[model samples]
Target: MSQDRTGAGLGVDRQREDCEALAARNGWQVVETYSDNDVSAYSGKLRKGYRRMLADLDEGRATIVIAWHTDRLHRSPTELEEYINLCEQRGVTTQTVQAGALDLATPGGRLVARMLGNVARHESEHKGERVARARMQKAKAGEWGGGIRPFGWGVPTGETTKKVDRRTGEETEVPVLDMDKGVPEEFAAIDTGHDILLAGGSLNSWVKWLADKGITSTQGNPIGTTEARDILLRPRNAGIAVYKGEEVGRGNWEAAVSEPKHRAVVAILKDPSRRTTPGSEPKWFGSLIYRCGRPGCTAYAYVTQSGGRRYPSYRCQTNHGGGRHAQKLDDYVQDVIVERLSRNDAQDLLLPGPGDVDVAALQAESEAIRRRLTDLAGLFGAGQITMAQFTEGSDTARAQLEGVNKQLGRAATQDPLVPLVGAPDVRKAWDAMELSQQRSVLRELLEVTLLPPRQGRMPDGGYFDYDAIQFRWLRGPEPYYAK
Candidate 1:
């Protein structure tokens, strides 16, 4: 006995009863029973009971096969052909409650089974098409597609499903989607990832941080680099609906991140220049964050040989004069950033985000500027204004439009200093960060320019001059050290 799914299709229990009744009417003794409940014959999914039954027939344990109908036993034409061949070898006479006895020992019975299999396959195909169309419609309207609940957002209200235990034949009730209940922590985690990426941090660093936080994917698997990246890059996170693997339109659910942030992240991820080199991640905190201050030189400081000294050193990549002990330099940079983060106005060092700027207003202004330029063009074409007047008006409108556009662009591209904005123990937080993250933070806040070595040496090793290593603030006014 077999049953594909509930509703429209008979339950496996009913099918089993009917088969038993038919067996009793024929005075046939029931030897063993096999049922693949809730498993579709046409889905090509593995059916353990079906396989065991076939083995029993081949071993001569059973000389006959009984089912509710031929279609239930086999839906695929290919599967039917295989079953027919196996039955012919065992001379297994088939019995069904609704359909009459099928003798596969002859060509006629095999032909009938094959024909029924084709009809069952066609019906299943049509059903699949209908279900797919319904899913597409739901997605276009931004409705949940009815499956496991998404990570941050809730599913459609009151969605539950019955999960069957293939081994014990037990039914477990499970809620699939509950759109009213959202996971606040997961939503914040996604925003953290977006901020990290915009700050020039790697997805691998985010994965490590997530692991340390004891958080996994919604599916309960360890979130790797790829999964972490995919979760943040999902269109649904931005309230965009996707169907059949392509975005359809806006979703009904609230967006987790701003549209500008999402678009910026997407551009960064999809850029052709993104590095895919394995093990190419930066090992030094100040690898490329510090630059050579030699005259007319634009080389970044990098790790170099230290002449058998235990400590590692950094030198100008272009072989300019400036170099420093790597560990000491990294520590000094970390101290500066930690001090800045510990300040009361640390958050002020970040670029403006969606909360600071009215993105919609900027967008509207940009559109209005564009419309004015169009009107100016129309005025010129209709001979309403002289050429000189037209040129002046068009230029002015275009300039205004450019400024508005720049504001709109900045609205989407916020500063990547979210992690260190407010920390109780700023030094501890800095120490906990990955090298890549530390480098990104340094690059975001200030520039470290490694100047040339001292002109005259006094001690065994020339003393390093702190003033020679110039600092320049990027987000705010330069401090004493920066000046």
Candidate 2:
């Protein structure tokens, strides 16, 4: 069996022809042909044709096996021993076009075959070492390792030229990866995905958006939620080089996302609390988003239709005896968002002025803090630091990062309502946004707290008390939702 296609895209056809001619010349009646093209025996990847040939021998269908070379027929010495055992059981001998015969019938012949296989195994090991070294050097130099095309990267358009081997005077082909180039569509998709994540959009929502935009993965299949998150979080998107699962350095290719955005997106995607339902969409505005203001509890509240309530109420999930009318709460929040966003002063109130925080400085600080956290974790993982030390170090680093992220957000990355700050028809624009986006806006601008029920019953016999639903402005102008 042969491995890999030729420069002309022909796979093992030449080797098969030579083998067939050798069989014909020897007057050997070939029962069946076995060819595993574009496959490698040295690498231990499954060779379908080779396995089938062994099966034929075991079942007494064929008595002799013929191939291109002994190295192609047998892999390591261990694999050769197994082949020899099977051959003796089946009373079979092997013939090769180059190495002549592999006589498993006698002891001396077996010794010679075993020695040759050991030699080949040694060569394969040395070759693997050299290849690994070369790949690591390439990665250090910011070159892409050849493989299936990575999403959000350009398709390779260049190939390696033939080189002459020094010892054998044979021409060999090398594969070259031209992934340093840029694809506009893919880069745009990466940017859009990062933006969606930063704006509090769910991973599932981004995947749906990918399908709606007809953007499949590099393999041309619909991107899954996990794959989408992985692609967006890949360090390559920020032009960071990686070798053997470790970041090496910067890549030669242009970054699809800013470094700060890349780090922030990574944090967002790794958040345990983030919603990850692939196709499910949020229905209510404040479900599980508004905090329970039950005096002492701070757990998120969910809308409940049970408990004999006529309407769904955003009830506390921690068995806290409190809930507010979901409809009335959502309506009040919606009006607040629409009115504030429609004002002429919304731009000055919502967005940063010219003398705002320094974006570059915060970005540098964020990177340094992340690096410290990574090193600290590595120390803890290596048993060089105590759990208390790691926890303290990690918490401090993360707290610093959190502050930097906030400043970075104010600098311009986190606000999704920049487009609506001074729009001519903010109400129309707000109404046009999807429910998830509206919730994101609400989450950004206001923090809703469902307070516990009052002692006396309402005069109108309603459970939702306007005074009980506390709305605190998190950003922009404060709306008059307070008592």
Highest TM-score: give the candidate number.
Answer: 2
Error of model 2, residue 343, in angstroms: 9.3
Tens-place lDDT per residue, model 2, 42-84, is: 8888888888888888999988888777888776777798899
> What digit string (tens of lDDT, one per residue) describes model 1 on residues 1-483?
334543333477788889999999898989999978777888899889989999898999988788999877988887787888888788888988877888787778777777777888898899889989899789867888876567787654567888766556578887766653457778888888887777677888788778888888788889987778788878788776777665556778878887667767776677677776666677888886688898898989888766675667888887655447787777777777788778888877877555676778865665566557657767988999889998898789778855654554456664556767787787877777667667767877888888876665535565545566788777765453532
* Candidate with the greatest lDDT versus the true structure: 2
Alpha carbon RMSD to native, model 2: 7.5
**Candidate 1: regions farther than 4 A off:** 1-10, 155-177, 204-224, 272-283, 288-308, 314-324, 331-411, 415-438, 441-483
User: Please, what is the TM-score per model?
Assistant: 0.65, 0.73
Candidate 2 lDDT score relative to the true structure = 0.77
Point out the worst 10-residue segment of candidate 1 by lDDT. Answer: 1-10
